[model samples]
Target: MTRVLRLAVSLALLLLAWEGLVLMTGVPHFILPAPHRIAAAFAARFDLLAAHAVITATEILLGLVLGVSAGGLLALTLTASRRVRGWLLPLVIASQAIPVFAIAPLLVLWLGYGLASKVAMAALIIFFPVTVALFEGLRRTDTGWIDLARTMTAGGNAAGWRVMLYLRLPAALPAFGAGLRVAAAVTPIGAVIGEWVGSSGGLGYLMLHANARMQVDLMFAALLVLAVMALALYLAVDRLLNRVLPWAADTTIPATSR
Candidate 1:
């Protein structure tokens, strides 16, 4: 498709510029390898990188599920009762204020240097956006729908459930999608930060190891793999959103979405 071609062209141009800059500056490969050298390094270490990729991806998946579930349930409680939101929502907001890096060591201290810490970091980064988006979605139900529910013997709890489940949820799908995109982008960063602080396996650990040993080629390759992994996760989330919310799949977003 034309869109795919354009993206390919854009990437090619970016790579070309990178290659040209390195050549013109006479930069050492150890300091900053050209694209070709980075590619060669990646190919040579493909198996090792693949293994680390699997670990990082697993952490992201498990964390995403945990964060979505907890955050969604919390948001539902807030929407169901004003008292709950008044008392409970501040804690949720406060949690995000704690720097993820600051908590990295604490997570390691509590969860050890395994997948647990990385998953915790990812969940922390992801939970707030999902909660906020779902909350807004529940609040955005149409007044006409509420009136019609009253007329149809679906008042009170029935009305709320019908709107929340059928209309508000579908309308909120796009925000949830947007929030997912933000969460996915941050997930890898969280995982890597965890690895930097304590983990034994993962691209982040591999990068630090390579750097400490002066294996610049291997480090560059790992860095490239990390970038690719983040992009891949983002794309996967986008595809899922489009698949589940086909109404949002169209090229032009409606004004009501604002």
Candidate 2:
């Protein structure tokens, strides 16, 4: 409750400051609409915003699922086979060298400006972080634990698979959780960028049309919605990670100590 109240207060203050700035500057509404104007626009276009927001949210969620699954699978494969890792890791690293914005147009061109393009963009943006985090985690699993497992298993043929399934995967989950949080934070960027490049529906599409029409208030409203959506997704991911990975709790110093 306290946290919620603090957030509300902070937002209210920000809006007030924004409104005051616009009033003082006497800027045209097309350039920078006041907060009240933005609120009015949001209220007037609630249905339109909701429709586009649903599309954006769907793309983000689907992309997250696909990225996480593919990344996890690749990490497992790389961990299980040194030859595959040697061949594939360089390619994965190289892929990130090309900026995502540069690829957005190509994705839209290939995927045809649909949900597929947006989802692919989002998945590609997050894939590297998840793969690297999980791969490192798997690789860095405590050697002592592996030694213990080896001794217990008596070096049988099934020992390797058994150790991996029971020991390595569980130990690596905390790192994966870290990667997932990062992916959640960035997932929206990819979807929005793809939509910006080309899309029939989404908050990014709405923002583009609103800007072209000089509906600055509406554009701000769409931006606000996107910000809220991204924040909510990140918070949800953080909470879920905390709940799922209790053993990996954050080790921040206390405020008093700091």
Candidate 3:
């Protein structure tokens, strides 16, 4: 397929550049391992890498599910209640102002050096973007649609919840999907950072251990695996979003100026 070929070519070019840099600089193996050295390291330690990668992947997946569920519920509640929004929206906005990594240590300390901390970190990181995107989408629903819904339900005891479920939720799916894409892309950061701060397992933990032992090639191999995992997760989420909302997926403008 064309997409597969393009990806392969891009990877080859990057590997060539990396190999060139190593040869030109005469970097030591401990400092900058060549592509072949990294490949050997990956082949030698495949089992170790696979184990750690599974832990990190589980943490990321759990975090994403928790974060998306919480964010969607909060967005819906916020939309239905101006009073709740008044009380909660400022806090939500303020939370984003603080650097997430700054609180990594606290999360580790509170949750302990286990999967819980990493999952919490990822959920926290994903929470804001999804909530904000969906909330804005719900808020910005076309007034015409809302008015029509209101008129139809006027005779009945229709409440705000009914309006949101019947009208705003449908209108907000595209925005929600966009938020999910962003969430999926960044979800690994929280897990990896949590591992870096304090963890017994995962790729970040392995990278730290390898670096300390001067196993640069192994560290590079782990890094490559992490990148591949992140890319795969993002692509999977993108495909799911496309399948769920094909209209949103297709409603994109061409990059070139018209």
lDDT of 2 at 50: 100
Better candidate number, 1 or 2, judged by lDDT:
2
Clashing pairs in 1: none
Predicted candidate 1 versus true structure: per-residue lDDT over 95-116, tens digit per residue: 7788878988999999999999
Q: lDDT for each of the candidates?
A: 0.83, 0.92, 0.92
| Model 3, CA-based lDDT | 0.92
Query: By lDDT, is 1 or 3 better?
Result: 3
Off by over 4 Å in 1: 154-159, 249-258
Q: Candidate 3, after superposition: displacement of residue 250 in Å?
A: 5.8
List ranges where model 2 is wrong by over 4 Å.
155-158, 250-258
Name every residue pair that clashes in candidate 2.
none
RMSD of each: 2.7, 3.5, 3.1
Any runs in candidate 3 off by more than 4 Å, and if so which? 250-258
Instruction: Show the lowest summed lDDT stretch of 10 residues, model 1.
Output: 249-258
What are the TM-scores, per candidate, against the unseen true structure?
0.89, 0.93, 0.94
Q: How many residue pairs of model 2 clash at the backbone?
A: 0
- The model with the greater TM-score, 1 or 3, is 3
